[model samples]
Target chain A: DAGITQSPRHKVTETGTPVTLRCHQTENHRYMYWYRQDPGHGLRLIHYSYGVKDTDKGEVSDGYSVSRSKTEDFLLTLESATSSQTSVYFCAIMGGAGLAGGNAYEQYFGPGTRLTVT
Target chain B: TQLLEQSPQFLSIQEGENLTVYCNSSSVFSSLQWYRQEPGEGPVLLVTVVTGGEVKKLKRLTFQFGDARKDSSLHITAAQPGDTGLYLCAGAPPGSARQLTFGSGTQLTVLP
Candidate 1:
């Protein structure tokens, strides 16, 4: 409900091809995250942004890059699509903790994008 | 790295039955959140527990944070088909509130 949207809801591409996924948020939240969900692995963070022009790598950041030039948009890029990269990618936005007075900060998510690499 | 383990990787139960899913971690968490995700959709936050030993109820769903803040549980009463989805638990280690580590998740199937 944080008004998050991911572009190209589904995509199919061949190996060695480049791909980019976009995550746009309408809430202007300060923190944005990119995660890939796979069976057994659950969801692993790919990248995250703390603010505009501020981005950091996550546990499974290999072969991925991200940029956040605007407050409402964060982009995740796969330098070369691989079979290992096939998974559902989710974008989430955090509005900060205690906005509602709780110690935990809730993250709003987008519908997600399913990518297939052949 | 903070790791959360969700038990009962898969559960199948008839509608109106009760069920509970557990999320456990040896590391103390500053806060924990539960999320439900349906097919082809991202996870939606069901509830968040921050204080140790806090319990919150949402309709027929009950969520409890362990007194040590190292574990949590989610229970559903009279489950319905609408409750069929993947339940994931995410936790933030003490001091860090946004960088989350998510559990493997429990896939619940509530049969009609």
Candidate 2:
């Protein structure tokens, strides 16, 4: 509902193949993030972007790469897919009211992309 | 890595029943948030608690932050079928606004 969308809502790829998922937002928020959701792991941050071309790795950034060349789009790429990477991927933008005079803790997430690597 | 542990990985209750979900951690958090996610969709923000011993209510749902800022709880009164979903709690550590530590989540199924 925050004007966010993820491409390739569902996909099934074979192992060792390259794959990419895209997150697009119209809110123009300064922060964007990539997350993977699994049954027992909850939601894990994979990567995040603070500004155009400025990005940082998150807790589970291994086996993944991201690029944010523009404010509206952030891409997550898996160089070689693996069964361990099969999970629901979500893209989020951080905005709204927050504490410490910084961006709030609220995150607006996209519908999510379901990637299945066999 | 700071981890938020949630209890009752899975729950099932009949409609109109009362239920509570817990989120706990050993590290202190500057703020905590709750989100509900339904099938095939992303999680949606429910409420945010920033102060210790703070209580906030959203309709039949009540949220309380622990007195020590290390835990929080969600109490649902007369739960409905629509309340069935995955509930997640995320905490923002002190001086950090760029990221949050999330709980593994509690999946609730309110049967009719």
Candidate 3:
């Protein structure tokens, strides 16, 4: 298990409210990713950060945004929460960017945060 | 879009039974990884196969990457209740190492 933790293990909010999920890692990994897991959809990437202030959108980045101001924290924000945004959000870290051998690209995930929009 | 399609969306079996879950894709991948996720928890890395036609085993679980590098399979022999969880397969494309295209996943329940 990696030293990764997601704040707010569970949360419930209204549809129009704004929500932010936080991911903190103690490993100081180079790559950090945010993903959502829903039934029949598996895990879909929302955003990822390669370094401080360097982030990119992913396959399911329509309504989500991310920021990485520091090395240890990656934040995912939902500007206005929607029922469709309810899902288990996960944070993961990879030591190498597919450069290191011996499964260095393999990701280590946090426990996950469950969000519900009513 | 590059997609990894997993079969047997839902599975239920008694302990000691044997089962296989598959992940297929049309695009070749640079590497393939399998993960097992428990309820309320993140997916944990089970194994990664980078070489085509590679086979790796971990105790009762056996994983194989297709020779084409476009598909993979996971077989569990004499399943136990501890195996109950969601099994996801993700493929890494060449060049970019940003995000992984994950399969729909298979929810497996092993009843004791």
Candidate 4:
């Protein structure tokens, strides 16, 4: 979807282990976001990046950290994975201009990465 | 409590039947977006409504944004088997980052 690629499409990890998910975009979009999807929760934003090396926490940022050293890549890291973090992770890139045209913005999603923790 | 709550969490209807899903929120949003997601895939953007009381149509699907900017609805006419999927509604509040708060979503099954 929209030239976005997420690595490790499916992964099974143990609790307390460190895991990292990668999102790569070819569109050169200025904004990038990481979200998690569960059964009851539709999609919760974990973190977002407005530009390279500039990151901010989202509504559900606890226990997760993100880094964006390059414009085309955004990485989400689970410092210590937990069973509660087992869910489908999606990467999205925001399109359109700056805040002036924010109303016209649209988010394009990646295929998604499924992580299972035991 | 969810910022945006979607009604009829699960819906099943016969082919050719009509149905509507509602999403309500207490907070006023600057814009609302509709998305359809299939199994093993991320949600795809269907439409985005900005102006209050705005109505947009994409073929058989009709989407409306509430005048108060706190609610929205999606209506499908003459549903078909291919319409089976999860529908999600997301809202963008008036802010700088332009982040979105999503609804729990409505799962629909159009049985033939």
Candidate 4: give the clashing pairs.
none
lDDT of 1 at A65: 97
Where does candidate 1 clash, by residue pair?
Answer: none
Cα lDDT listed for each candidate: 0.93, 0.93, 0.90, 0.92
Consecutive 10-residue window with the lowest summed lDDT within model 1 chain A: A95-104
Looking at candidate 3 chain A, the ten consecutive residues that score lowest on lDDT are A95-104
Q: Residue-pair clashes per candidate, as listed?
A: 0, 1, 0, 0
Q: DockQ of each model against the real complex? A: 0.75, 0.62, 0.62, 0.60
By the DockQ metric, which is better: model 2 or model 4?
Answer: 2
Clashes of 2: 1
**TM-scores of all models?**
0.97, 0.97, 0.95, 0.96
**B23-106: candidate 1 lDDT, tens digit per residue:** 999999988999999998999989889889999999999999999999999999999999999999999887778888999999
User: Chain A structural similarity (TM-score) per candidate?
Assistant: 0.95, 0.93, 0.93, 0.94
**Candidate 3 per-residue lDDT over residues B30-110, each given as its tens digit:** 889999988878889898888889899999999999999999999999999999999999988876544688999999999
The sequence of per-residue lDDT tens digits that candidate 2 reaches over residues A1-118 is 6899999999999999999999999989999999999999999999999999999999999999999999999999999999999999999999856542333478888999999999
Query: Per-residue lDDT of B1-112 in model 4, one digit per residue for the tens?
Result: 2399999999999999999999999988888899999999999999988888999999999999999989999999999999999999998887742698999999999999
lDDT of 2 by residue, B1-112 (tens): 8899999899999999999999999999888999999999999999888888999999999999999999999999999999999999999988885588899999999999
Q: What is the TM-score of chain B alone in each candidate?
A: 0.98, 0.98, 0.97, 0.96
